[model samples]
Target: MTTETPTPLVDFTAAAAEARAIADAAGVVITAVDEVTAARRVNQLAERVWGPGVGTAVDLVTALAHAGGVALLAAQGTAGEPATDVGFALGFLGWSDGLHLHSHQVGVAPEHRSRGVGLALKLAQRAVCLEHGVRLMRWTFDPLLAPNAHFNLARLGASGTAFLPDFYGQMADSINAGDRSDRLEISWRLDRALPSKRPAAPQANESLVLEADSRGWPHPTGEPLGPGCAVEIPGNYSELRQLADPRAPAWRQAVGETLAGAFAAGLTVAEFRNSRYLLAAPHRP
Candidate 1:
């Protein structure tokens, strides 16, 4: 008889527990937002993260939660310490043929950012997905946002494959106002290990196709395109917005065109380094 290989076993139970412990250590408790009061807190949290007119209604949140979606909130300073809601996430099940989840929104309170609240919420989302037999999670984020790019692609092990231009038209929120809702659609495989970091791409003298000028406006740097290119973005676009820079629109168009052109030519984004997107051309067979 031919020898058979045994399947490797995974300890998801321990994994879930470990995720919970991480949130606890961060002084935040991640839990399902089922109660009416808790749902209201999430609504308020949405406002805090995105500004006025962006928060979901309590009724809608409750409806989605009752329909078995992943609606969770992060609260600071757990038991007997006068806790408060600092972050929240709203997501729903995907109806695709394969098991999938679509994370619609995840936001952390401004004061509570950089405190592991967002990471905690994501880990909790993974646990909920596993319970529902979902193996794939999809989400969309603005491609110009550097921190978000790093978080989704590097920290959370998500990969982006598609670029959507003006996906939501003009958003009313303060954060997205005066900007096109260009998004990079990303996918995360819940069954796999969290990648420590994006693997380094092959060494090359990549051309800088899109780069910021001295005033932080994006311009086409006079670099000859080769097998690869680099697209650099401002380290903080929020500050650019605050400055009301007249070149903001130009920057948007320039970056959008460069990315679209590269992607259309069958180039893929390989890694994010030094706030630059390292793009690689398709390999010949």
Candidate 2:
């Protein structure tokens, strides 16, 4: 009798096809774009996604692509046809903690958001990373953005480990303009299964270091009293900015200080529940 070998757990081709199907269902086609023309389109998409002064330049995209970086573009149209760029993800090799892909930026056009385009782009990124033997991807996002928090932590299974206040200083981008640019640094362990959003139930009398009041203003409620605690922020930063609310700065400071203090105490963001960050020390189970 001959011994049989079991199939490998990850099937890259199947995974890529599945991601393509997802984007296809949303009227978007995901493809690898390494050419100057395509890269230029992606550059334009970056501007649309991140706002002015935040988009990656065409030349930079070309250079990164030529340097063997990941240059994935999502387009609108049927397969095998010339399509217009609607989204892009750019990343490159890194040697900080072994060879990993430091996903610099991923952006979908404003008009194309909420259609699984971002998820498709990320799934494609995971497929590419697995193909190249890269098992980790790192990125940073504004912690105040609830949708991003949900997407990164709950949907994609990434782990938030650190908070960097004023990481990029003030920016001129329309989205981030006049903001302190605090970032939540997260890591995606590609080998793990992505988890669905299962936000933990909120308990009454839980120690909330920060929370929003009746008018959607973030206020400090308590200090870190145990290994675990919660920090809350308004779920809608864009709305506050659009309305030019005077409370935006207070929200930023309150949340920033709470997160900074918790992180400084060696706590990690375990989960986001009910717009509250479940922070726990590394020693906690």
Candidate 3:
């Protein structure tokens, strides 16, 4: 977006105010953390290995300014923590905002998540991108999340080209939970306004391939893969794969056989994105 140089120090007051407004409307609160607190969180993210720390945010803001400026977002309670938390991310289209090089950092409050706040923050970020002539904004996230998968792929229409494993190696957080830390490097191609297109017409006669795994041909067992080169695919792929398995009756009960069957019929499978399968053209030699 128009990467306006946000004040060196983000106006926590104004950001807090906007957060409060949104929270109040929803009967929740979004609070901003000071540099100290932000810094600590950043430190924790750095020292510890589960969630991102305040340092990460600091870096984002710094790079934003360097790339022309980044907007730091926070959502929490009135004073302590936000009843609803949100982050607004902005970065130069071409400028890399450090932390693996990206230009946005919008997100929602952990406790106050859902309810469409992430989308709102993203929409707002897009406005900034447009204002600044940013054509492609990028970010990274774990590939196994079903919710985020649908959000990024089905919702925002982003495309992927990279895959980084143990991107941070290992985090001491519970969210990494049981899975290995593999991340998808994706780009939100905002070069142009989004298209007013509808979902693809269902091919009733065709079976859909809901998810792919690492074992299949395209994956090629230890084939070349990395952060800057991968593609997008569905989320909750592991769970979905189990469901899609013919032996599982519940799989058909959920997505239904038609959609899943059609997908399988139409596409060639690609690499494994943390248990989920990404479809792509057969690789060129």
- Among these predictions, the greatest lDDT belongs to 2
Tens-digit lDDT track for model 3 on 34-110? 34444334333332322543224455444444544545344445666533334434444454542222643454445
lDDT value for model 2: 0.81
All candidates: CA RMSD in angstroms? 5.0, 5.4, 11.5
Residue 145's lDDT in candidate 3: 60
- Judged by TM-score, which candidate is best? 2
RMSD versus native structure for model 2? 5.4
**CA lDDT of each prediction against the hidden true structure:** 0.79, 0.81, 0.44
Task: Determine which window of 10 residues in candidate 3 has minimal summed lDDT.
Answer: 216-225
Assess the local accuracy of residue 202 in candidate 1 as a C-alpha lDDT between 0 and 100: 45
Candidate 1 residue pairs in clash (backbone atoms < 3 Å)? none
Residue 245, candidate 1: how far off, in angstroms?
1.3
